[model samples]
Target: MSDNVYQKLMRVQSKLKAPKNQFNKFGNYSYRSCEDILEGLKPLLKEVGAILVINDEVVNIANRFYIKATASFISIDDGEKIISSELAREEEERVKFDLAQLTGSVSSYARKYALNGLFAIDDTKDSDSTNKHDKDNITSLNNENKWTNPKLTDNQIKRLYAIAHSKGVVAEKVKSQVEKQLNKKVEELTKAEYDKVCEAYENIKVANS
Candidate 1:
């Protein structure tokens, strides 16, 4: 049987190499940004006669906000395509505090995961691991030491604890893990760092469950 566009896309998905080029100070780990994934796909897509498009929507799930992102893979050969959808939660508090930042953050997260699904990438870590939001790179990923980087608020810390307790993990463990890894106090951690703390708890949950 001759290879079709769908099979070509599957081959590209299996071969795509989107490296984790970005670094996270909080977790001391590296992760692939949405941009990194897209950049890596360009030449491969061109080779495979395929194109990738990602779309995002702010949708509600369980009365909470989520970014529903869809990644479409289309082949120039016969126009056959594959689509994948992923959702990333948006914190209501962050939405109220800074809708622009929160939206961009969650959108990138969703889009990254969607693309990951379409391309068969394994992402063991969350978006918080990299702080890589394309639209707000300055506010989140780059300026960890800039005085303008705001620390996690009291409410945000409390929220972390609440989530920890709900998940049957000690809230203090989350804070301590972040603080130890980042070498900063919880109050001194930036908003991005707070997300890393949340990711830590998520890891614990996954490990135990």
Candidate 2:
């Protein structure tokens, strides 16, 4: 019985040290970003013969939009993979930016949490005591307004992808086209924007047919 993937990953995670490289002026505290963790993990991953992959998806459940970030660690020796995911909700108020910025912010947050979960990084202190901004807005109307902008469901995303694929369009190409058209990521699209993407792909399928 060889050592499992979890044990191998724990060995690497034990050697990982992610320093707080970012400072929050509002909260007067230091923190680390997802990039910092990734950077720190690079050499450790190589040493441990593991590969780290991070991915994001937007999910809509019950009319609420959430950014789901997943981090996977794959062992190069035995091809074993371990995955962890974290989700962050999209804010509704649009305090200073548009939907794109909001989605980007949430995506970054989700990624951070996903990495934290994967590496067993201690975030209780940072999140509980230093995250004054998030704590203050925890119950804000912007955060609570779940109905302002509806999101596309998983089925809708699958349908859109299927339509695009049938028309010889790759997922990246479709996502790039949608981003260019709306100046936002496909995951950040509102319900109307998502419908437009579906319609656009439908037109392509019709043309090919």
Candidate 3:
């Protein structure tokens, strides 16, 4: 689509306001948390045929660390919000090296206490999938023996994709090579290994395709 179409949609979205009761308790902010805003906006975006994505980065703060949260909205609208990462960074900086705050938004120092409320799904669940995995563990697209835990998060999937391609061959080709090297096919491998093999192949295909 053209940029003009996108701009027009955003203009319409800007005029759409949140409900009068949209405020959150305790925080005393008239505006909703980013998560809450997204929750409410999701259905509208879908109805209007659009998508939203977020990008985050860390900024140096007087020798300390802070995060910048950018919410990108696409579809019929295109406005964004950038909240202070101070709280998120403070909360994360205090964490010890070994503990896992799986669902916390370290940048905003926001923790997911309960699964209820408007933004619950986006809070803890989303962050967990983004920050918890190592990049090197990704299996190749064709490697049939690489095993992955079923509960891996979305970030893990992306990391796996990166790992699969880092070796110059697609994950599938690498997986196929491994199978050929071992003289066994994916079916010959155990169920535990079956998914791994497929993942390796998928990664390769994703990278090469």
Q: Evaluate model 1: give its lDDT.
A: 0.66
Instruction: Write one digit per residue (lDDT tens) for candidate 2, span 1-209.
Output: 65678887989888999998887664456878878889999999887778999898877766876777889999887989999887677444444446666667677777776788788898766632224323211111122433333344444576788889988898899888987878987777765566668777778634433
What number of clashing residue pairs does each candidate have, in the order they appear? Answer: 0, 0, 19
Instruction: Sort by TM-score, best first.
Output: 2, 1, 3
Model 3: per-residue Cα lDDT over 1-209, one tens digit each? 53443553454355443332334232232332445554566666566555655555655645655444444444444443211211123321222333344223342222211111212233333332223321112111111323332243443444444565764656566557657866765334433344464465555533355
Clashing pairs in 1: none
The 10 consecutive residues of candidate 2 with the worst lDDT sum are 133-142
Best first by lDDT, ranked: 2, 1, 3
TM-score: which candidate is best?
2
TM-score of 2: 0.60
Model 1, backbone clash pairs (residues 3+ apart or across chains), number: 0
Local lDDT at 154 for model 2: 47
Candidates' C-alpha lDDT? 0.66, 0.69, 0.39
* Local error of candidate 1 at residue 168 (angstroms): 26
What's model 1's lDDT at 18? 87
Give me the overall lDDT of model 2: 0.69
Please, what is the TM-score per model?
Answer: 0.59, 0.60, 0.32
